[model samples]
Every structure is written in C-alpha cells, then in structure tokens.
Target: MFMQNLPSEVLINEVSTRDGFQSEAVFVPTDKKIEMIDRLSLLGLNKIEVTSFVSPKAIPNLRDAEEVMNRITRNPKVTYVALVPNEKGAERALATKADEVNLVMSVSESHNLSNMRMTCAQSLAQFRRICGLMEGSDVRINASLATSFGCPFEGIIAPERVIDVIDQYLEIGIQSISIADTTGMASPRQVYELCSLVRRIYPSVDVTLHLHNTRGMGLTNALAGLSAGINQLDASLGGIGGCPYAPGATGNICTEDLVHMLESIGLNTNVDLMKLLEISRELPAMLEHETSGQVAKAGLRTETRPLSQNVIDLKNRNEKH
Candidate 1:
C-alpha cells in the first residue's frame, strides 16, 4: 500500500545528536549539542538519542558525550538514550544516568567488520557482555540492527538473518528493536514483508523503523512500516548523519519532513512542525553547509500558496480516500 491509515499517535525518536553528528568533520561544541537537546525536550519529543558513549578515537566528533549529557536539562517525559558499543561504553552511559542504552550491530558480517571493525559473531559476543552489565538495572535497553534491509558490501540481506539477531536481542531481555535501512536500499514491498513478519511472530516486542532518504523513499517506506503495525520511527534532524564506514551511506530520513507527512495524513506525531522547521532552518548556518532537508526549502502544504489544478486534484483524490 502506498498510504496507510496511520495510528492516532506514533513515537518518533530523534537521533540527530548520536547518529547525526558522528559523520561530521568539524566537532560540534558540547554546548550546541546540549542546547539542541534541551530545546527538543521542550517540544514534546517522545525520545531523543542524546549521545554515543564510544571512544573518542572511533567518532571524534562526539568526544564530549559526558559534557553533553550533563549540560542538557533532563525532561522526565522524554527518554534520553545513548549509543554504546560494549560493556565499557554502557558503563560510561550509566554513569551519566542515561535513561536508555542503545546497542548497534550490523546483520551482515562484511558490513559489521567494515563499520564496527568486528565480525558479526565477535560483535554479538561483545553485546552479550554489555547485556550482562545491564542486568538487573532500571535503564531501558534497545538494540538497533543496522543493515537490516540491504548492505553495500552484501547486495541483499535475508529477513531470517535479521530475525536471528532479534531473537538474540530478546533473549538478552532487550524489548525494543530498531531495524535500520543502513544504506537506504529498502523497497516498500520489502519493508512491508519484513515488518509484517516481525510483528506476526514477535507479537509482544516493540519494533521501530530507522530509515534513510539516500534513495528518497524514506517517507514512503515509513508509511509501509506503519501499515504493517510498526508505529515507532527514528529520524535525524536536518537529515544529518551517515556511516563513516558503510560505503555510499547517507543521512537518515529528515525528522520534520516525516512529521509533516504523518500530520498531513491525520496521524498524531505530537511534534511541533513550525518549531522543527525553525530548527532545520538554523542547521545549515550552524554546520556551515546546506542540509539535506527539503521541507524547509519547500513550504508545507498548509502554507499560503496559490492552489493549482494538480493540487486540487490531489486534494480531491485524498478526500475520496
């Protein structure tokens, strides 16, 4: 299906700080990261991936994770999550009192080694250690399976490969799982089948879709995921972020654009579109380069504009739906 009768409310987890910044060449000041997170907190965001607890050597841009976490004013309603690679990183995240710890591993062995410098089996071994560290803790644990749809090195990934990792995640007591289209190669049919299959078997688990717009189908794929009963979605502000190791990887689905699409379709995202647009507008000046977001460049549907025949036709068609 091209469109879906979307849920009344959907959870959008902002990952700009964590995933978005890791690829930048310039180091964004800790104050700036805190400022953005604090502002996002007040905007009624469901969750925000604050920072990654990785080594400064891995992603030097986010070296100040501790300072960013400490500087941001915590909002109880908003979940503050941090990415951790292993037990050591999880320990640091726990020290900062992060509300959640997000672990990542690619489903493809080649992609895993390329991006994470570890084989898939080795990555899982490390994840098991991290899981042991989080045992008997209040901190929420989530696993984001990267390259779930397709990999640059490996052409197509089997859904069974993703399901095996998800089963392992569940065994470790991780309830939330994000299947990311690491290189933006997912088709709508592939999205539908994967989400439907995951939900059909793992009825109790919370599945989220983390998609990218590298191929310009992020919103379309998101609609397909929702059509299959996956309500949680991950997006990056200003469409920033790509894997430094994954070949041909690019920024994630733009957060404001996704929200605009959902809101236009009468789904409740609970995000302030005007405020998000304002944020997207400032990013280009802040980053010293044009961002990948298009909504700010193009006015939203509700904006003041002369309606054309094409616009009228679309409106009439949607009304009939």
Candidate 2:
C-alpha cells in the first residue's frame, strides 16, 4: 500500500530565471529573461522566482532585475518571487511588488562565509532588518537555508543546527522555509529525517525542498521529502543551476523530468508537462549549451516511435519463413 502521509498534489516553484540564470557566465539579455519568465508563467507553476535583487557586481547576469520584474506580465494564478539577500535587495524586491522575497543563507558556517561573506548569525541579523522593512506590506518572506544537508567545506551538517536556524527564522516572523541541498550531497534517508522532523515540529510553517542533481540523487531526495509530507519543490528548466561558491556542484533537478515522474507516479503537480518539455528543449538554443534534462531528449515514457524500414523488413522475412 502507498504511504498515507504523501500529498496528493505537489507545488512546483520554477527558479530558472533566478537560481538558474545566476550561475551562467554569459549574461542572459534582459529581454530574453523577461520573455522566458512570461512563457513560464503560463505553465501552471505555483510560483516563479523572477529574479534576484542583488548588486550588479555580485551577480552581473541579474543586473536587470528591476527591469525584468517590471516588464514581465503578471499571472494572477502565479506568485512572482524574488531573491533578496539584504535590506537593499528587500527594498528592490518590494519596489517591484514581488509577491514574495526569498532570503537565503547557509547552515554551514564555511559555506555561508564563502557564499554571502557573512556568518550565519550575521545573515540572520540582516534578515531581521529586512523583516522590519517588509512590515505591514503585502509581501511574504521565505528564508532559504542553503547547504542544509552537507557542506563541501564542512561535511555532514547536524540536524539540530538546521532546526536551530529554523527556530530563529520563525522567531524573526518568517513563516516560509526552503531547505536546499546546495551541493546535492543529500541522501534519501537524510532528506526524509530532516523533512519529517520539520513537519512534526513545525506543522504550521510552509516548507519548500530545493534539490540538486549533482550527486544524481535529486529526484530520490525529492521523493523522500514528499514521503515526509513536504509538498513544495523547487526545480529549474533544463536542469541548469548550481552554487558558484560550492565547488564541484552541478545543476538542479530537471523540471520536466521531475514533473514527468510525479505525474507518472499518480501524484498531481498541475503543470503542463508538454509545455514544460517544449521550454526545456529551447534552453539549449537560448543558453548556447546542452541541457542536463532527460525527458526533453527522450520523450515521455508513453511516447513511442513507429518501426523502421530495416526492422519492418526483418519482421516480414521472419514471418514469411
């Protein structure tokens, strides 16, 4: 029998425009970014991380955050999200009227220092100030904990420390949490344990699982999260995204592949799988590089091809004999 705790429908958050594009060395033109986001909006994603409101020096590719955010046509059914690292980013995100601002930091001290140039405590303090800035506004705050499973510099993050960080985020009045496998070192058991703990301890908070395919366990870990009662997942189109600060890390789990698997397993994601595949197929041309997605290259499991002439001739000869 199937697990009773598994959710019937999972919520997919598309992050190509923010997390995916940030890792590219080549700057994706502002118009292209806006157009891609507009196309993604119609694919039935629950939320789309539109862009990051960061300094151009830090992430030059997303320097056009404001312009992209302003130009993209809003979908009433979709929540537009923006990555905000500090008060300045929060201000920029708010100015663009983003529905939600994702604040990120690392659970590992070494990773946090390398990625944000600040300790976890400093990141929390900055988040507090950002919270104060968003007070009374309609915008929502979501704290994303990077390197939650394992750190490249510091292997094996303790579960207690992750819970402690979540406690601090809750105290700061942030209701949503995103548990990220920054380097994709998370095992299925590790994902299940932490996600189950979070679910049991904090039943009221919203949780999103952001996984990477670096170690080839992204989809497995996602399944573990779902079995642990997590319904929200973050995926990138064409499976393109990784942390620049995390050495040897690869792209995220492919959005089309994940959606295809979910739907195949009798779980509902509400996303248009065909449209998603179409978008995934276009990524290679847009990025000028091949993508990591599988379903896009090898169509859906049900999609079949007709017999070739050679096969037909062989079959006819065998039947004639």
Candidate 3:
C-alpha cells in the first residue's frame, strides 16, 4: 500500500551552483560556475538554484552571483532559481530574471539567530518586505524553512512550530516552501510524521524536501518524505553543501545517488543519470578535493565487471571439486 501511494514522478531541483559552491573557502571561478551551470541546463533538472543574492561580505564565494546568473544559458524546460535574503536580493534576482526567488527562514529561533543573525520574527518581517517588493514582478517566491526537521543549536524542533511557520508563510502569500533538514539530524519516522502532517493540513502548497547527509540518514529521510506524498526534492552534485553556521553539518544528498535510487525503485526523476555521473566525476578535479557521493565512487547497480584472475581460478577449482 505504501508503494502504491508513491508518486510515479519526482521533481529534482539541483542546488550545486548555489548551495554547493557557497560553502567553499576558496572561491570557485565565475566562468567555471557558468560552464557547469550551462552543462547542467541540458540535463533534465526541474529547477537549478543558480546563485544567492546576498551581501558579498557574508558569503564571498558566491560574490559573482549577478554575473553567473546573467551569463548562464537558460533552458526553457528548467526553472532557474535564486536565493534571496532581503529586498536588495529580490531586486538583484529580478534584474537577473530568475524564474523563482527562494526566501529562507529557520523554524527554530536559535538557528535563525545563528544563520541569519536575526530572530524568527525579524526574518518573517524581512520576508514580508521582500514579498512586497516582488508584488508586481512575475517571478515566484518559495520560502525555505530551515531546521524544519532538527536544529544543530536548539535540538529537535516541534512539528507544531514547523506548522506555525508554514501558516505564517501562507499568510504572507508564499505558496511554495522547502522543508530543510539543516543539520541532517532527523530520523525516518520523524520525517514521515512531519511530512504527513504538512501534507494533510496544507494540501495546496508546493513542498520540497531539502535534506543533508550529516548523520547519513539523508536518503532514508527522503524515502520517508516520498511515502508521505512529497514529490519535490533538493540535491547537490557530488553531495557538496552544508550550512556554514551549523557546526558538524555535512553536504546534501548526492544528486546522482538520489536519481539512481529513485530510478532503481521504478520511480521517475527524469534526470539523465549518465550525464549526471559524468558531471559528478568532474567535481573532485574541479574542487581539488574528494566528494561524498557514493554512486559516483562506485559504479551503478546494474554495472558489471569482468572476473579477476583470482576469481577465475577459484571458479575453475570449484567446478573441478
């Protein structure tokens, strides 16, 4: 019955260029960012978070947000998204012609303070102001509820707190929301409960699950979300992203791995797995470090290799016996 209720198709929103690159200490060159994004455009991603429009001093790695957004080759089938923190960011995102502007706030007060350097109420007010600024624009708004599952500083957040945040988001007229496990501390049962509650109460809003592999529960939590009727998910190439403000937090769920799992389970992500693997392979050389993605390190499940000499000899001996 659980399998029967699962959606046939899922929408994968790639966040490598924005979320993945933002956490790097060394700046990823703007041209390389553009090249990678252009390459990703051809792949069948439902959306690509191209960049974040924030103060350069805050996140210097993504300082070239404007130029990257302006230069990327747009794919009509893909919705280009930009993360915006305030009115200024909304202006910049609008100028870059982003298809959607993602607004972020934490359901946990401590996380909101640590991440955004403000209280929860302040962030909500800021979001309202940004929404007002975007009132006349054609671009859409998506509220990202950080620490929806759990918070590094404050510990487990209550489901009622999360629902209240969603209530405020709806009140502010933001219909799309992303429920993020900022530190990846959620259990599978917790994920199902919260996601089920959200789906049951607010049946109209578009919800996207943003998970991390901090404690290696990312994929399991995602499966739980799917069981709760969630079809939109956020993943990063090579699994490269985490909250800079959250201590001990790790990267997001690998895009290639997620696509591979979904496809293996007879669900559709509509992503080009081979092409995604090619891109994932390039991350190590490009970033000058090892990435956390598993499928990229190991071959796909259906892949095969010829028998080794030792295995061949063992087989012959066994046959003779």
Candidate 4:
C-alpha cells in the first residue's frame, strides 16, 4: 500500500550545474552550462545551486562563475544559489548577487583535513566568518554538513556529531541548513534516524537532504527521509555529481528519477519528469561520461508503447517461424 497522508509536496533543488561538472577532468563550456541550468529552471525546480565561488585556483572548472551567473536569465520562481567555501568565497558569491550561498564543513576529522586542509573546529570557524560577511545582504545562507552520515576516512559518524554540527550552524543563525551524504555512504536507517533527530532538535529550521547514489541506496534513503518528515531534497539532473576528495564516489540521485518516484507515489515535486529526462540525455555528451540514471536509459513507464500488429507479424516472419 502507498504511504498515505504524507506531505503532498516536495522541494527538489537541482545541483547539476555546479556539483555535477566540478569533478570532471574536462571543462564544460560556460554557454552549455548556462543552457542546461536555464532548461532545468523551467522544469519547475524552485532551487538550483548554479556555481561555486571558491578560488579559481581551487576549482578552475567553475572559474567562469561570475559570467555564468550573470549570463543566465534569472527566473523569478527559481532561487539561484552558489557554494561558498569561506569568507572570501561568500564575498565573491555576494558580488554575483546570488540568491543564497551554501557553506559546508566536513564532520569527519580525516576527511576535513584532506578535503579542506582544516580541522573541524577551523571549518566551523570559517562558517562563522562567512555568516559575519553576509550581515546585511539579501543573500541567504545555508550551512551544509558534508559526510554527515558516514565518512570515507571515518566510517559511521556519530549522531551526536551530526547534531552538534547542526547546532553550531543554528547557533550561528542559519535558519536553513542541508545535511549531505557527501560520499554517498548513507543508508535508509541512517536517513530515518538522523532526519528524525534533526526535526526534534531544531523543529523550526528548514532541513534538506542532499543524497548521493554512490552506494545504490539513494532512493531508499530518500524514502526514509520522507518518513522522517523531510520535504526538501537536493538532486542533480542525470545523476552527474561526484565528491572530489572521496575516491570512487559516484554522482547524486538523478533529478528525473527522483521526480518519477515522487509523482508515482501521489506526492508532488512540481517538476516535469519528461523535460528533466530530456536534460538528462544531454549529460553524457557534455560531460563525456555515461550517466547511471535508470530513467535516462529506460524511458518513463508511459513512454513505452506496445508495437502494432503489423510490426509484430513482420518481426515474427523475419524470425522464420
């Protein structure tokens, strides 16, 4: 039986424009990037993380961040956000007039050291600094806790650790925060427990789940998150994202596939599954990697139609039966 009386609507934030391309060895042209995001915005997605404001030296692929942000026709319905690593990055994001800035820090000490070259405390310090920088601007801040479920370096992060990180961000005054399975190490049970705890601890804060499909548990965890009362989800079109620091970590949950599941279950995401599939088809050629999304490979259930009698007879005759 379908789960009934659940929240009817969900908010899916598309992140392909930034997270999907950042790990690629090849650079996706700025024009193509702009085109992709523009198409996605029209697919009824209300939030799209467009680019990052890190030093060009750190992420050369997104060095054209400003141009991409300015060139794309901003949609009033969609909020365009940028990832900012530190105070300087937040400053850059503000300059681009980003609707919101997402800041992240790793929960594992080892992953934190390897990825950001900073300790957990130091990373939170950076987040504090970023909050200070955005003192009086229209730009909103979202604190994302990377590897909140399990880290590559440190397996199975404690729930207390996750709550502590959330508390720190909340104390710093970020009303909206995202918990990311950065390395795709989350399980369904983890999603249920963590999301439940998050809701209990900070009932008012807007909590979004950023799930990765690296371990093949993306959809299951998403269900668990929903069971735990999460309405906001982060996904990438074509499932094209990878963690730069976590080896063998694949892309995120595909946007089209996620929408398909939600719609089938009588839940609403306000996204067009067909249009999202069209966008997914463009990823392989653009990124030079075949996507792992099932929807991209096998079209939606209704997309398939039975063959005509004539065609079936022709096929039978060709078989020499």
The TM-scores of all predictions, comma-separated, are 0.91, 0.96, 0.95, 0.93
What is the C-alpha RMSD, rounded to one decimal, of candidate 4?
Answer: 3.0
**Clashing residue pairs in candidate 1, if any?**
none
lDDT scores for all predictions? 0.88, 0.92, 0.92, 0.87
lDDT of 4 by residue, 235-293 (tens): 99888887666565667998889999888788999998888888889788887878878
- TM-score, candidate 4, is 0.93
Q: Which residue pairs collide, candidate 2?
A: none
Extract clashing residue pairs from model 3. Answer: none
Q: Tens digits of per-residue lDDT for model 1 on 16-123? A: 988888888678888888888999998778899999999999889989999998889999999999999878899998889899998999998898998889998888
Per-residue CA lDDT of model 3 for 67-99, tens digit only, reads: 999999999999999999888999999998999
Tell me which of candidates 1 and 2 scores higher on lDDT. 2
RMSD (CA, Å), candidate 1 to true, equals: 5.6
Which 10 consecutive residues of model 2 have the lowest summed lDDT? Answer: 242-251
- Model 3: runs farther than 4 Å from truth? 1-4, 243-249, 309-321
| lDDT at 306, model 4 | 91
User: What TM-score would candidate 1 get against the native?
Assistant: 0.91
lDDT of 2 by residue, 1-321 (tens): 345578999999999888899988678999989888999999999999999999999899999999999999999999999999889999999899999999999999999999899999899999999999999999999999999999999998889989999999999999999999988889999999999999999999999999999988999899999999999999999889865655545688889999999998899999999998988898888888888899999999999999999999999999999
Q: After superposition, how far is residue 283 of candidate 1 from its true place, in Å?
A: 0.3
- Shift of residue 193 alpha carbon in model 2, Å: 0.7
